[model samples]
Target chain A: MNITTKLNIVPFVSVDSMMKLVLAIGIEQFLTELARYVEEDFLRWESFDKTARVASHSTEGVIELMPASDGKMYGFKYVNGHPKNMLEGLQTVTAFGVLAEVDSGYPVLLTEMTILTALRTAVTSALAAKYLAPKNARTMAIIGNGAQSEFQALAFKALLGIDRLRLYDIDSTASHKCAANLANMGFDITICASGQEAVEGAEIITTVTADKKYATILTDNMVGSGIHINAVGGDCPGKVELHRDILLRSDIFVEYPPQTRIEGEIQQLADDHPVTELWQVMAGKASGRKNSKQITLFDSVGFATEDFSALRYVYDQLPRTGFYEELDLLADPDEPRDLFGMLLRAKQAAS
Target chain B: MNITTKLNIVPFVSVDSMMKLVLAIGIEQFLTELARYVEEDFLRWESFDKTARVASHSTEGVIELMPASDGKMYGFKYVNGHPKNMLEGLQTVTAFGVLAEVDSGYPVLLTEMTILTALRTAVTSALAAKYLAPKNARTMAIIGNGAQSEFQALAFKALLGIDRLRLYDIDSTASHKCAANLANMGFDITICASGQEAVEGAEIITTVTADKKYATILTDNMVGSGIHINAVGGDCPGKVELHRDILLRSDIFVEYPPQTRIEGEIQQLADDHPVTELWQVMAGKASGRKNSKQITLFDSVGFATEDFSALRYVYDQLPRTGFYEELDLLADPDEPRDLFGMLLRAKQAAS
Candidate 1:
């Protein structure tokens, strides 16, 4: 690229381009490669600047800005979670992100994170399950069967070799939709009538429901002793998926404690409730699963570094796939001090 | 716009389009109108949810995310300030912003804010001057004529009717460039040898030097009684333009106290030192320019609401000007829960 193009243009990955790129790479491989990036970042989590997302809470939902930097690169994701949006035929969560250079503070990539978010979230859950889930885990129960359900199934299958699926949703149509989407993908699938029935013989359970209020998608009685819980949907204050008793029984692992305490399942517990940082387990500083009968929970509210990894992954793919368009997002004057002169010249050129 | 377009496409005002839009409406008139919006927002300042900008500081410079919401609409600007960038033929600052609706939590507009920020910062200064500047101020002195200098000159001309200009810069070429950019724009221009020479016999002195250090552009002795000082450049920590003695002599005005205390010229002052909120003066809650001999200083660190006003103004201008392009930034699946299904269809369509 020329100097003007280099300064002025930011490569934007649109929804269409993201879909095309994912399809070109194949979804399972994309998730697998993305998981590696997420795992690598998690292992060195202390190197990043991490903070609870800055959220603007309205009566309807919340809009958040999640920012992270690993000293070399900076990234932020603008995401909105409006559970009611689905009633109006809109996605419950929509997002976009930017990744920039720490040296110049210039954005190198802008991308639609709606699809990428689903992919990263699922891969993160599977990565957690890799250490926490029971050995030779084969069957998984997905209790939401919504937009994130299929990705969860695929990510588990890609990373852990789990090929059995049990799906349940409040609306059976959602379960059907998820199962239909995953058809012929080499998984044994079952659409269950209820969350309890779905987790009957499952070794891992995922609750990915969408609601803005307190929810108990899984109770203590429903969860067995050894099942690893991937709690995906209880990501905001007053929004949770598992029962307090269930959380009390499970060993919770969180991405960031300050954030998870306020927005994750652990919010149901006291402030000093003990939880393990997932990074420590990946770095071998802490143990993941202690025994066959120990229950583990990955309280996944989604952190900024995961999104950073996703952005970095997509930015690296830009040259190989060429699935992005250049956006004229920044002002680049020939002379840096002559911004006003640039305008004057533009006027003169136009006239 | 169709439903799909309404949901997926955000109107993007690029650098090229922003220049075109500004030229379409004369620059003076644009500044005047934009100043009106800034004034209106300031009039209802209590309506906004304000916070000190979120900044990520690097050894070289800083990048910031400034967000504001008035319960109905939310807006944020991503800006980076790197003073060393000019040497590499890059802008000292570059910015872009997003304006989104609160009800649905969907972005309505995404625009390049490099030009818009310059416009809004200048307009905000002029708006503050309307309340605090000495009455009938016709001649203005502008020191450090860099990228922001010409806009500052034009804004003062548009809002305060200060037609006589005295410009000075360490590098005289910048002053000449400022003079040349403003040629035949209804101004009596003079290139002065020093800041003291620039301020001689002028009612208003605007110090807008670009440096990321604690260099005083204006000394206490140079600032006389009855003069209004518009301090614009000392915006971040360790960056101040006016000497502390000049600040002590003047009744200071600021955009937001929490922010201005740390980033504005008043960072040199005690934490509890009295400073007037510009909005209070605009809303008739506080006094401005109590007497002709009393010094007044408008310490502008640039705030989120000003950028909000700028984004709102540009969004309102979209239909009339049609100067923006639609960016497919959001994912809008036909069925909200069938995001995977949408991807499947895309893959099938591509195949």
Candidate 2:
């Protein structure tokens, strides 16, 4: 596009285009590269403008806006979680995001973040596992085999070289579907009938269910010493996966303390409970896994910076892959103050 | 559009489309109708969810997200203000917004709000003037013939039948442009050399200069008894258009007092300074223009509900005018829990 047109146009990545881009790069590679971006941003977390996701809660579910800016670029994601949406043949979570230049406050990209969010969340889990999971771990129990299951399975395989999968879901078909999707993607799959059976001999466990209410997907007896827990589902208030007893034994790592305290599994704990920031672990300011015998829990309540990084990564990849369309999203009048003149001219042209 | 396609597509109104929409409806008629929506929403203000705008301020500018929700629908506007942007041939203020169904949290419309915001701001000012301005007011002094000046003039003309405009700006070219734009638009205009000169026989004085710092566009001496002052320029924390003395003399009215106390001309007032919400007056719970000899000030710092009303108005108009394009902005899978399956199918189809 010409520079003049570029000023007014924003690159939009639809779901189809996002999928094409992911497939073109190979999903495993895409997750790995995206994880690197997330990691890089996390390492410099102090430089970002961080705030808790602004949530509007309703009787059924919640919609949230997550925004963050790192001096130069500003990004925000609009997402919703309605547990009952599935009954109406709609996804529990659907999202879209925009990334703009801070200097100009003009959006350069708009993308279907439902898919991108799934990818980023999975990659973030794997990134934490790389630091908190057992050394040379080869087995993982995924207790919720829904939309995020396959991505989590692949991300762990790509990031941590874990090829063994033990999957279980409240719905058997969901587990079967997850196993079938990863059937040819290099995994020894075990579709278990119960959550306990799923975590039988696994070194790592990822809980990612889609219920809006609190439920124990993992009991204390199911989790033993040295196993890492990637708690991904219990993100909002009043929702949790692991039992409170399990949290007492595990060393919890969180994204942002203020947000995680309200949304993460640690919400079960006191506001003053000690927890390590994952960014500090990555920055060497804090330790990750103290020992193999000490259980490590990654209380993953996704933060805005991760989405910002995901958008930045996608923006950088746009020119290389050309997997986007230009959207006429901003007004670019020839003269800044002649906005009325522009409207009059448009009327004249239309006539 | 077909139902299946409509489920995944959001209608987007671009700048050109928005301009066309305004022209097709006629600017005067559009403003009058928008003012009606604003009035309707303001009257039922207690039924809406309101919050102060979330702002990310920088040395060069500030970017904000203003969101509000009625029980049924939700809306948000992303806007930025950069005083230095005008020097770089960019608009000091630019915006876009989205309206979504509260139940589904799915966006139904996305539109370029730069033009729409101008209209709504003007209509909102005129709406306030209808309740607060002197009876049968026909003369308005516009101090700041910038981008917003013409809309302000026309909205008053349409809503309040103001036919005379005295325009002034620090820059004479801006005043000349404002006059030339309103030349044949059914208004008798005067280009004045100074701000004081502009207010000379006007019944309503609107101070709308675009500057980042505190400014005295209207001093205590410049404002007189029984005249209405539409203060629109002093919106952000450190910006003020009228002198403290002027605020002390006027019977102040505001959109949201908590927000206006920090961002509007009332920021200069004491914490205990009393102000009436304009919504209350529109709702007939409070009196407007209590006496003819009293000065009334509509401290117009803008509000999110006005944007919500504007988005609601645009959404209602879309089907009738067809002034929008469908955007593939949502991810829809046959099975809500099978987002991964959707991606996998896309990959297979691509192969």
Candidate 3:
């Protein structure tokens, strides 16, 4: 039977709605589901033609386009990261994507990514932690508790079997919000006074601060052996979070090397610094965490492939649930040559 | 006083409706008006930061993202060209675009461009022809007779005093359709059997064939002196309509050499091939045709600036006329951190 009676116009989940969608689905279930999809796409990674995103930076922020095609279909995301936007009542990260048929380049999906990005980021963190974090992990220290922190908390709880969260933010309200959301999720909470205090005994530490600076969110002394660091915030060049010494302690993993080298925390290291491609690890061509005591770092800057997978999943599943509206977005010419004719008729109809 | 009370959403003119909009505006009037906007934007050329569009090519077609910024605002056009799509009852060309604030990357306008592409292509052709075609030009040869043919005829009438159209198409029905559309616009028409026969006494020759190959629609021997050729269809690499011999005798003009080299008809020529940029001629920094005897060719591939100008104009004009439906395509969050809260409220309201 057909899943839905109506063709779902592109489901536009606003940033606000996305937060609810995650909550309604429960963080654990969402993370588990999203991870399954990301893993499925990563195994066949060679099928994709990947490129570094094209970015146009302004004095305030940067807008970028990340496009990739897996021979049969093409997908791209237009995203912007403006940390100061929160003061203007706007989310720091807002995005949208288009998935088109590679044969004809017809746009088959369009979606609001402000909320999805949060979900995808959290899901990605959980996915990496599953492979890199110590087994039977139960506690996660969330530093820089801003927009993406709650999702990270939920994702870890769902995927890594984490039962406790230690939250710390420069702004206490951010920490309060994250802890409040995790209250009923079976994750025990600790409101830490500092990033160091939060990471003291956590098995996995997730840093998602929004400040566009070279912030050392976690230093070398803050961590003990066997902790996995999911570094999510430092994506653009000159924007980083982890200390140089912390990265040297762990075996570094990256999504796209050329890009991660420029935008991830690895940007601080030498060009010839040793790093392993995450896809290799996912495909078993490379190892994930060698041993429980081996310090591991997943320098996640977010890749176009993850967005492609997210867009694909959203287009496939969300429509069946009736959370979308059809848009008369693409022009359909009844008689292609009579384009001028249709405009005249619309003018007549309006007049 | 609000001049328009119809809607708040920007009017999305579909390819079909865009045709009707063009028809109502009168192709000649529309083309003439479009030329003014294009000419004005070209004069302030340095005010725009130009980059060649990013493209993904497959065996069947190609998809491209063309972006540009002018200090205050940013714009991008997502377009595709698939010659075989017509066989599937889909138009060979389909497009859409977004206009956003440079500071925040907030999209202010999103529109259907399949129809607007036709209008802009025609407008660009007429603008180039105005500067390079013979003063007494009246009759024109339209060698392709597809979706773009009527727009070409109208733009020529609007910008230059050319009211006579000599058309030809490999498909006779395409020529019939173009002639029928222009019949009401008061143009004297000739539906020729072949490209050679159509060029006789035609002062302006526009070749817009859709084959993605280097097939010579117009050979060197057939094109005579004092004829201005507006080559609109050869827009990607490995596609050409004119023989190399024609380039030897004609003074070629292009828009944005970096892009023209890749997507325009100039792809067949050597890297250092001499072709003057059209913007230079518009700004009077370079000369146009030397005399009526000179053969001029404008290898027109669609550019980002024209889409930017057209989007700006449409966005501004829609408010005055009131024919648009606003889409909640962008997310505007209140209390940015409580994105989850927004979803909670939306789901509650829906329940």
Candidate 4:
């Protein structure tokens, strides 16, 4: 088969390919570039067609499809969150995405997004910290030391110059694994025994617990003023991390309010609670951190625009990296209307 | 690589495989089996979670995602319709879909749906006609002789024992092609120059024109009492095939009312228009065709449950036919929480 005969093939980046690409570009640089893409998309937020994710809740977990388009390109991610998947030796969250040309509606790229989701989620948090965190803040606390903890630590180090991490988990083995992963990465890491000890003397805090309910991981007395909290885990209707009193004391910034109010930590608050849109802060229309003593909260539920940016970034890197395989995902007959003829021809070709 | 090492891989069925499967099963038998699946799901329609398709419209065309879940399995299709695409030698519509386990939230099958969409749409039409069309309906007229003409003709032949087809299209070449495709398929076929001539003596009339506007393909004067009309072409907001007077005179049956009222031929009717739900008719809770004098119209805009049934049928045939390839679309590590470690290990393995 000639290469030109397969123009309908879509480029697919598998997990191995994504890992090789990330390692080839250097993980720190990958996070930095991904953060730049997220920031750039947030800067032009109004140009996107945004909608809240369409979710299907089941007894086990939830499966969601997040779709967004910028009129030129279209992208969507299929993701599932099953907290009990870890017991079955599966990742709690796994994802895959497609990017297509809006004009032709033909897919250009399909890639594994389980790894990319972790990278983008961390980069988005770090980018928010750049605008919302206090000036000269370096020490950060991560409450859940699971699959996302190491990425968050690395992204903050790359984007916000945070070199110290205070980590805690219900399972100490997880904290040990995270600490060992970041051992030689030039961070002063301390493995704490409890969540309260992890936030001690920390300037920024990120809570990414794995439970799927409205269980409070942090009380109002634990969160102090002048600290920026990146609430990463409480991102569903009944799932939240911080206490309502803590949210009342802080100014919250979110990706899209319509979506955030449903899936972010602010779901616990009243419907009309005033929260600043993160794009407004990025566009300089709204203040991020009002003062040095102001308690700031980055309610970090993931958004579609961020995935669109990540997909766009991966598509841009495809030419340079060549780390993709083309899959025959579309049917393009010589004469488009004679699809039956194409099928009949296939039978003849096989014979 | 070992076989078990790729356990996380998904089975992908391309267009060629789908065609080979259909041919191997015999086209008529395939349609019969697919119709059985559609009818079975309709019998238990209340068990499925349904939502209206998420559509993104551009100046040229529209792309949509149709998703549905039956508590145990979930499926969605990504489809695009561009009316202007045919001018550039491209398909007016192309589609692909995924089926996943709701418990595990892992995709099991990914298949090209362009050809499958045509087959399933025809099967769905034939299934609806089973309940809605008049008894002993044999001779039928097809208004549009484009891509969907042959399938609709064959499905009716296999399901309803229709032996005669009168086909008409503005483009005579399309009608000739449709006639050519069904030459030896055991049908008494006639090529008509106009829609009025096509429906002259037919008991059932199927209007499936390709125009994306509200140009009336069938006038009120052309339709007679007791004739069952399968309105297939006018499926979007601004697209309709039958005249408003024809719809008002006909007792309409729809797949899903909330969806059909927005995209089906009934979009021209009032929001409070009384229409019978097709599933209720299949479940024997509602009447289909009351009397021979009553004109019955099946406003077939298509629905997610039909796609879900088609995908389920394809999945059941995968193991028997062995017509699929494995795609490593998921990221599964040895230790689920140590995804970063998986990346690190890949670097060492590559070296």
Candidate 5:
């Protein structure tokens, strides 16, 4: 007679449940906690095994897997960007991630990442600007207002105390949508007509456009001295936002160099070109902004470490509020060696 | 007035449910289809964007993410291994994967890879042996009889017509369980006491041990000349099965070079060691077994392409067989950009 056993499996955290988790935690509180997690991980920058995201591109869009670990826990995110998906009445992006124990390679959590990605990207931008931008930066100039615009606005408010926003979009309704969403969020707003007008007096200029081309949304002439530029949109081959002259003039700070070189604004620059890794700056090994007249550019290409930090933060915080559902994503079998036995029981249960 | 919209979300196939899916698809049919998928993808070996898996390791185990694309479609599998998991009543390995369109990067299919990983490994072994081993190879020696032993035996039978199996395990009860499962399937089996005894006169030899430490399961003296050795279990940094002499005597073939150098049996060899990729062999660009007197060593650590092929196969086969349920994993809102609206609706539903 052959004796077999079973393993325990966890439940999954679907997109709906994730949304509830955020709403339950309250977006404001979530952003504040997220800021701390990102900052903490950024500080311990050397402990992680980091890499640029591995991407597979097609004519329409790209799907990527971003993985990173801090010697103990491992995290990887599956994300896709399909700008054309909106035309088909689908999301411009969708994502999910796994948080696993490095000691055993068992996934402890599996959660939807579409909403989480938005929150993290916004939080990352806010965290970087907190250190790189001007000390009293109160107003931000946002160009290419789209799906990610509102999150950026909210994170800036939550992290940097940026109560004033100047917004511009090629599509006027996008600005209207962003302005309308922040109608009573305790922020002053200016709906500018063009990119030039939007950044005229703003202290920090954030570019989050959705074009897949080499977009010069902010030219050299428009960039003012001492204004820190958060170049967020140009994050891959053939995608960029700043004019070549802006990178030529600014003190460039990047996520991971190899990735930023291929995906961030530095893709426009040469191989031997100089740039600063954001982790190094956070680690105090490198300087951020030297003087008020110096232009500091955080060429944000969305690093795997940021996602790793973000996912870990969500995993820690969501459970505290009792807002997340436990996902049975890993199997805990009764007999460690008898995987086939699990199937036998499932078959019996079905019939 | 703001129109609130919500997408109906559901939990897709989690690791535990994949165990259920394997049973739902029927182990025999799943293996058969898996063999077909593995073969189909191998035939078109040139059409893939392949890379080494990204791994994050701790002292006890490792978690890895593997991503690949064939231009039209994309797939990624997350897998982990821990020899100590079994001591805690957990499986030594677990895996899950996502299949998506390259055009948009949105996953259309997500699956449990624990069962599928076994199936693919077995099918890959059988397929490699088909090209390298004797056409009339009838019997196979199976060492390290664990969760994957049954699949290895069956895949060889289905793909290579090996009707007889000689099985051996350090834990003899594992062999007993394997023989019991195959009692109805009709294969004459020899339950041997040792790896050497298991290999007596078998045309093909399969070594898939679970122990993470270096153990010479099959020494050069045990494996004869002209035998096709499918070394499957000697994966990761510290694990290996065959003696270095076996590799010295055999013609080595691998899935991907850089990965095999780190994880496969070839890790024993030098960095610049010459080996043929299995695809080149399968595509007839390179040779398999050069002569009847030669020993062929397939250093199988598994690859992203095999998972990509297996995932594509699962996605295509599941819908037709009605073996899976629709998972509302992604948000499908009525209005494309109104993800916030979904929250409003969920709030109403809960209230």
Candidate 6:
């Protein structure tokens, strides 16, 4: 109720404010609550207008725009992925998003989505695991201990009650950094030497290594029956984390097939390879984990609706947390047709 | 060189800053310089990537994303068109855009585009007229007197030395308002009773009425030879201003053919109807106006690269004018892999 009343002012959540809000609410509770929003949207997934993200790929990296609308409110995220950015001391991914009213076509909220994306991605993985992971699973093996590793560890702990984390990365410092960040966050952490060692006895495997090429982080021999594989890193053309044999043996559940076929782990499989829509499973139209020993792979190439849900959740929290700044992003003349007059008056006032 | 050195800080130009920058540089001079930037991009048009805008249409209005990149710098604009918004005292079109570095996929500038769009649209039209309009033409008629009317009037005067004006709108008050706004700006003005009367004795006719339907502002009979038509308002599917017969008679020129076929005045023409690309003419690869009697129509459905050029121009002005604020839009961690650590530090700092 204390938000900006000016028509031209849009509420903007900066990175600092996002961090404060997340910490204020407690990270696990934020993830748990955000998961509910994501699930609510997934339940009504058929109602959303979905399209594959428009991407501009370059030799250095790719920039993308992901847009979705539920006919009432529309949301879009501007995101970029450059695997080589790490060597330059920058994030491999950075993002921001906007939520607007469809009726008026006016933006209501703009927020930094780098942090929210990590949160939503982890929550989505854990939400899928709730249906596909073995009952009472308490251990999760995260194969890449990069920027997204700790969030995955915490989300699993918050949603699935999985507190045991086995973390591994090609860079050992990244594994140590992940363990250090999750310290006192109720996670029982282990720094593992290899992907094989990490998944030795883990019930859930989350592969989120950041590579722009087809480098298999999960070999067929590393994956076992009844293990839920969350393929997070293999999301774009020529990027894959899991071996083809591993995907062939698993029952893949995807966010959107059209996008997944091009960007998810399923990109390695044949065009006709069957995959269940996760929303159908959530809506009870399709089954998830038919048997205890069935290998369920949530081929998680993140969807725009998930970002929409995250933005909606963040917008709803603005009133309670007061964690946003009003941005003068729109030109609002006193008379809609008098935009030039507004500039002239401003010049006169300055003189 | 005085901008922020912080990696996460992006320079943001709000509406107020945009108005100030435009006024500081003088509107006509600003339009002239921006036209040069736009013309420069058009001259090297083949080197850039182009796509039809991604649009989400609702019964009430439409929201669109226009994106383009020149391999080194990428830009995109978020814009909306809601004709009914005018009845509710809102602008029919509002927009904002971002310019980013393609190498790192990092946004360098974020600015309000509603004002910039108006400037660029006017400049583009005048630039096309330079190639397509009759030499030394003076008198002009603008069919719409809404938010974009004054900008078009000034851009024509600035670029082509046109000082005589004739304006008309369905609402006479809009025309009166436009005339009053341009008062003392060195233009000989006349208010017309109808679109036909507005075009009388005018060398260039600009149709920019803001109706969402296929309402004819210019018919075949009114379009005489040796007149260049700058059609600005018929920029979406099912929204057109010129009569189909007028399109058949004119040598239509467009920004991009793939987009014009769906959203410009050319939409009324046959699929294979001959239309010249404006960039080809600017690049000297094609002819613009073959003779003085040829009827030339520039179907102006705005493009992404124009927004790119405008944003680049504004960004270059920031150092001289100091009219931007550094926004904390991206999350920067001390270690690229320690995003969670950054949050923990934020929490500690807040406490």
Docking class of 3: medium
- Per residue, candidate 6 scores C-alpha lDDT tens digits across B1-351 of 326779999999999999999999999999999999999999889899999999999998999999999998999999999999999988899999999999999999999999999999999999999999999999999999999999999999999999999999999999999999999999999999999999999999999988899899988899898999999999999999999998888898999999999998888888999999999999889999899899999999999989999988998899989999989999999988789899999988878
Q: How accurate is candidate 4 locally (lDDT)?
A: 0.90
The number of the candidate with the highest DockQ is 6
How many angstroms is residue B344 displaced in model 6 relative to the true structure, after the best TM-score fit? Answer: 0.9
Please rank every candidate by DockQ, starting with the best: 6, 1, 2, 4, 5, 3
**Candidate 2 residues A1-351, lDDT tens each?**
222245678788988789999999989999999999999999999999999998888878888899999989999999988888889988888899999889878788889999999999999999999999999999999999998999999999999999999999999999999988898999999999999999999999999998988899999999989999999999999989989999999999999999999999999999999999999999999999988798999999899999999999998888889999888877777888888888878877877
Please give the lDDT score at residue A138 for candidate 6.
Answer: 94
Tens digits of per-residue lDDT, candidate 4, B209-293, equal 8777888999989999889999998888898999999999999999999999999999998999999999999999999998889
Q: List candidate 2 stretches off by more than 4 Å.
A: A1-5, B1-5
Cα shift from native, residue B289, model 1 (Å): 1.0
Per-residue CA lDDT of model 5 for A77-167, tens digit only, reads: 8888777888877787788887877876777677788878878889888888887998888999999777777788889889889988999
TM, every model: 0.99, 0.98, 0.94, 0.98, 0.93, 0.99
DockQ-wise, the better of 3 and 5 is 5
lDDT of 3 by residue, B1-351 (tens): 222222212234444445554555655666677778788887787889888999999999899998888868778889888889887666678788887777877776777787777888889888988889988799999999988888888888878878888999999999998887676677899899989999998988999999998889998889998999999989999988999888878999998999999877788889999999898999899888889889999999978999888777666655544445556555554567765545555655767
Shift of residue A89 alpha carbon in model 1, Å: 1.3
What class would a CAPRI assessor give candidate 6's docking?
A: high
Tens digits of lDDT, candidate 3, A200-273: 88999889888888888888899789999989999998899998998989899989999999899999999989
Superposed Cα RMSD, model 1: 1.4
User: In model 4, where do residues sit more than 4 Å from their true spots?
Assistant: A1-7, B1-7
Q: What is the C-alpha lDDT of each candidate?
A: 0.93, 0.91, 0.80, 0.90, 0.81, 0.94
When summed lDDT is taken over every stretch of 10 residues in candidate 2 chain B, the lowest stretch is: B1-10
Interface RMSD of 1: 0.7
Model 1, runs deviating above 4 Å: A1-5, B1-5
Candidate 6 residue A92 Cα shift, in angstroms, is 0.7
On lDDT, the stronger of 4 and 5 is: 4
TM-score of 5: 0.93
Residues forming the 10-long window of minimal summed lDDT in candidate 6 chain B: B1-10
